[model samples]
Target chain A: MPDTPFIDDGSNVPLSELRWPDDDLTRIPDWIYTSDEVFQRERERIFFGESWCFVALEAEIPEPGSFKRSYVGDVPVIVTRDEDGDIHVFENRCAHRGAEFCRALRGKAENFTCPYHQWMYDLKGKLMAVPFRRGDHGEGGMPKDFKLEDHNPKSLNVTTRHGVVFASFSESVESLEEYLGPENLEQFDVVFKGRKLKILGFYKNRLQGNWKLYHENLKDPYHATLLHVYLATFRLMVAGQKSAMICDESGRHSTMASAKDDNIEIGEETASQMKSAFREGMELNDPDFLNYVQEFDSPWTVTMQIIWPNLVVQRELNTLGIRHIVPRGPHALDMYWTMFGYEDDTPELERQRMKQGNLMGPSGYLGVDDNEAIKYLQDGFKHSHSQEGIVKLEPEKEGSTETLISEASVRALYRHYRQVMDI
Target chain B: MASTHPAGTNLSPEEARALRFEIEEFNTEYARILDEQDIDFWPDFFTADGFYRVTAKENHDEGLPVGLVWCDGRPMMQDRAAAVKTTMVHAPRYLRHYNSNVRVTGVDTDGTIHSESNYLVIETLMEQESRIFQAGLYIDQFVREDGVLRLKARDCIYDSLLIPNDMVYPV
Candidate 1:
């Protein structure tokens, strides 16, 4: 590893200069993680392209006139419910001057009034009023042909599945159900299942790494058994557990799932392989922390769904959350977490969910490992002259796998990524 | 909900001042333990049934039930301490905790004290400049265990909406 001083400006490497190291997905070029040109291209071809990005949960803005500030990739947007109880997603930029008008994270309002010029827009993002349309005292009035509707702010194609909200810049994008194929949809529904969601709260943290690394982290289960000693030591998701890394037809989305088996002992060979991660005699003083209430109908106790480009639906035991990945340039990304429970949950169940929440988040037992690892990875890519990352765990496998020791799902993600990015 | 403290037991000015002094002293020691990164001893500052949580003021003001670190009991805190010490992987760093403005609000009939204080935690990583990691207010409920003040509950409500990377250590 050469400790070369790498300049991050887009000028260092042209987009045309970048190419795959090999014709296969086993070798991932480091430029994809550290190049500014690649990040800009991702914003265009992936985030603001044809993909549907998860913006907000319907539960966040449940009532009419409720609104929450959100993002599609790096572009700020507002997710709102209008007077008609219809959900809408539109740019937070004011139609008149492009100032980010909505500042509060979440609130209820009849309409939004831009503080810059008092240009008012209805909840549906239609320009309803212009303070100087006729000009104050008729001095600087707009042209006679200016129409209020013509000046409306940009809006995205909005769709909802169960309680999750997704938005796309492309008007002709596929439906949300079709976007998440049948296999992925089945696993998605296992957690959603039409039950009203109760918002527990939120956790926001910025990880100093490429946004794609977050998706890859969830898709790569090999690291789960090796990097996170807490998870492996407790057998929440050890290597020998019943698990599957199931990918969608397009290879863009996947679900890394595992069923917790308390009585099933780890085989000797597997235990030896995971010796560094598993502690011989460690135990939680409160054994109830790892208790599985068995609330869902699915067999897997943990199903971490990497839904294409921006969403991660986490069903880790009883703790349920949606992680929205907001890319910030190439070196940093903001992770917004929305933790929830069903509306009809008993007080005890809600508390249990909160207790279980300790396993994930910026400060969680397992989550801290991933965040730190991502930071270290970004540091490695930024400072080192190394140009390739190896993903050849199971050389012959590509899509789904029954073994946790494979990087098949990671390879599958890049297979779709290369096509979508046209690299 | 009615007040858990009994009415008409308002403390004298001298008693309130003395209680505030005790709380200030207790917080100074608490901050020292965390600043030194002696996480294994972190659980001992709390009562057996102690509750600890670290949440953003946005969520705390909205009465949200979630926490970045929600531990319902001292056992859970012990688990977190043990894991942070033995299992979790993070960059080497130093943290300095500044706790001030201790105010004792009330004392229940059982001598449990309600208090609030402002805190600032500055972190310095290897080869990096020190920065304010978290600035928060700690809302606490304290009780005497064998004549020493121990926390019954400590709600660390952070004012920073976006954590820098991750809170590797508890504040």
Candidate 2:
């Protein structure tokens, strides 16, 4: 038999190999996490190919001329609002030699001038001036053929909903509403609630693993009550909690809604009986730290909403934020998390949110635990080169299930991945 | 880390030499404890009501209040130590913190010493070469109690915007 190449850059790896074994959405191959070819295909077909990717919150560029540079996959783009108070997104590349036009993380400017060649562009990405367009003297001017109108930077179809900005490179992509679907749209609204978002600050980190691993980590809900001892020990979540894994019809987005097993009296009794996660007689050193006042009409104590391609709007017990993903390559990616709240929030509420924020970020009490687990997950795939792995936890039906111990949401992500990549 | 009577960031020749030696020794000891992973004694380095926070310089410059790790008192710091010791699971790594350029900026009349120093933490994972993990300025406020120096506040403002993997221990 021909020696099967266990390790490949994914060029020679056949498209047939991309298909899940036995056509099972629950089965994921290791190669998907390791293939550069797969990453490029995803960039082309998923990111640049007909998807509304989250760029910036409307609040980030609230004023006219205010702009923030963001990424859709690996392609950097500028999100700016013009003097007309309309949001627009375009490639940050300069028209002349493709250097980045907007270099700052954020700033306000009447227009942008590329440092490389002094190619000036209006706030809306219209080419306005060129350094040598008219030349030193009229005698050296061009043949009167270089039209500035023809050389404007490439722009995208952009929209702002509930102070969240989304841009799509493909004009043919569905409206942001249709793309998010009704389920995700409802959850998004629940988080945004028409309140103006405030850019509190950002927590950024680079994970030395596949970008999908983060998604997989969120979709894999079973690991939560096991790994994050803080959650289980506090009865914030447990296997017996009344939870649900909600996947959209498109299978591209998902929301995990978990109501604190509310029966904590009984939950704690059961937990105290358990040996590993729930130890007995543990109390918060500062009970004030758990001073959460539910501001939402929703019942879920913790809601992690995953928008297709790149956005995660999170509400972890009054701590609200968005997690944005940028794929560095197949093996690594960056996560920029912006923690925020409403502008009119009370001082006490803001303090509560800030204190509660400790449960998240690269060093969060609960968040760091997931990183370690995902690192372990990536380590497993780096060596195991398995053709297909099992995910059939509560796999009776795939879209949404009323259980926390299910990998159906992860399967939902891959289902959309297969359709978009045409595997 | 603390310093005694490094008044107004100026001193006589003898006092300057003595203060420099004291502050340098204080920093060296602080770094050594963390590097040696004597986490139990970590909180004792701080005053009873001291504050500790680790935030990115980006956030600090923007005046953002959130931190990767924010502890309000020695109790909270000790709780963090306990959590890191018993609860957290981290891959085996050796961490060594280097503190340099200790500058005592000012001294309050109440014996609170204000100092700043540059720090670099080198981490070596099992079977991996050591890498510069974090480089930042230790913006500190120190106070003395019963002639013993203790940290009043430590703001570890990390300049590197991107945190690698996860943070298992305090900076």
Candidate 3:
């Protein structure tokens, strides 16, 4: 008999059929963005394997019994705070018939009862009771020894740092601090420094592109100079600014940091290079929208951290938020944006934050450009006969660089991606 | 047209009908300008200190202060209009606004009118079918400037939770 390959899902294409176009880190094959086999493997190896995916913020479910619907990969999960004030993460599927019982996006619940079969579960995801377990006056009761504990829904290993929540499917996943190494942790702490967070609101939008494109967009500072006119015109981030793309040793996480310079003038050569982005007479009618209140101790005015696979922590001047990427398929993804502020922020600061929010989200001055570019990339890959997309700018470098003309962070991401996917 | 009616006096049946007709005419012109893609003139529909915000129904219900498109004054709106017109890059599309159920909820002592209207926006991208983009309620406060109704505040609370890609233009 022939040796059968392991195929967990019946619809997934075999892994042997997919191939990388070349071994070079500068060239990315289009199949990685359009293959179902690769997507399934990524789900198995990265999102569901040894990765601590960010699920929710502690401020979202601040009180006992407060629950929010979230996702680990594409699978649905529930993040809850029990009566003991301990956080728990469990699959939303009912243990009896595999029904997604918790329907609301978020709410406070004492206990969950599956509407299909009436199987009840506690806040900790323990099976508390079952309707008609004795089956109508003992006519047809449960078999001899059925244990309530055995039928509990599958739960995950939950951990939190500062106020951010993360969940993992692996039992022996490393500590959150160790996962985000010392260098990455230093930048992470700049935003989450033990102060209470007050969530302002949310912005949800669906993009017609793969989920990883978002990470690439943040990592590739090459695009920030030419693509976003608002960033370039307003001098929020330009080519000659003090910027660094800091990637961790594992290459899975990165922080693209840049400081704003009000007095810096664009040189002739640099101005010629960014002709489309930098306008000569462009000025804001409301200059207060560009006000940068110095709140953080860090020197960087913008620190966009891509925390591997699923989360993006955004600190763009005074505006602060976290973007949770949920992959729908190979070609589509949904972004859930949670815009927040600190509890001690004054009314003026809050209003400032709100005004500066025009630079972000789906309809933002800078954000819309990226979304359109990603969509165009996806359309090109899907419709054309191109086999590979080039990422060869500053080709000699790999992890981090000081120049804005490099794709070192993007190349670093692919290097890590190739190892994990075993391509 | 001078009248014997006091500032806080209730309008007669004929007066209420005339006021509704005038407000509807204003809304029709507003929609026509937006649908025609004359965005430079969009800010002129509001007073100098008018406020405009577009937020989800969920956030409005929860009393969340954030807005998808938050403009505190006409200057901010003008800035947004300029960005969307000249700087921001987005796919070209056409949007048509359909507003109905215009109701004059109340009238203040200073002749400021508070009204509500249901709105629907249908969008058509290049070489794509026209689809419903957003459906919402416009909670508005209008005050006359030189006998012309100008929006003092327009709060667009959308029912669609997940916006498709981007909403480049104002609602």
Candidate 3 total steric clashes: 0
Worst 10 residues of 1 chain A by lDDT: A1-10
Error of 1 at A292 (Å): 0.5
How far off is residue A89 in model 3, in Å? 0.8
Please report how far candidate 2 places residue B14 from its true position, in Å. Answer: 5.4
Residues A1-423 of candidate 1: C-alpha lDDT, one tens digit per residue: 222234552225667978898677999888898788888899999999889999999999999999999999999999999998999999999988899999999999999999999999999999999977887786898998999989888999998889889999998788878888899999999988869999999989999889999989988899999899988788888877799988888889999999988876877787799877888679889899988888898989999999988999999999999999999988899999999999999998898899999999999899999999998998888776757889999988898899998998889889889998888
Query: Per-residue lDDT tens digits of candidate 2, residues A256-310?
Result: 8888753566355556644576555666666677556888878888999888788
The candidate, 2 or 3, that scores higher on lDDT is 3
C-alpha lDDT (0 to 100) for residue A408 of candidate 2:
80
lDDT of each: 0.90, 0.81, 0.89
Best by lDDT: 1
In model 2, pairs of residues that clash are none
Number of clashing pairs per prediction, in order? 0, 0, 0
lDDT of 3 by residue, A251-368 (tens): 8899999999998898989889998888877999998899899999899999999998899999999999999999877777899999999999999999999998999998899889
* lDDT, candidate 2, B12-76, per-residue tens: 54665665578788888989899998898889889989999898898898798888888888877
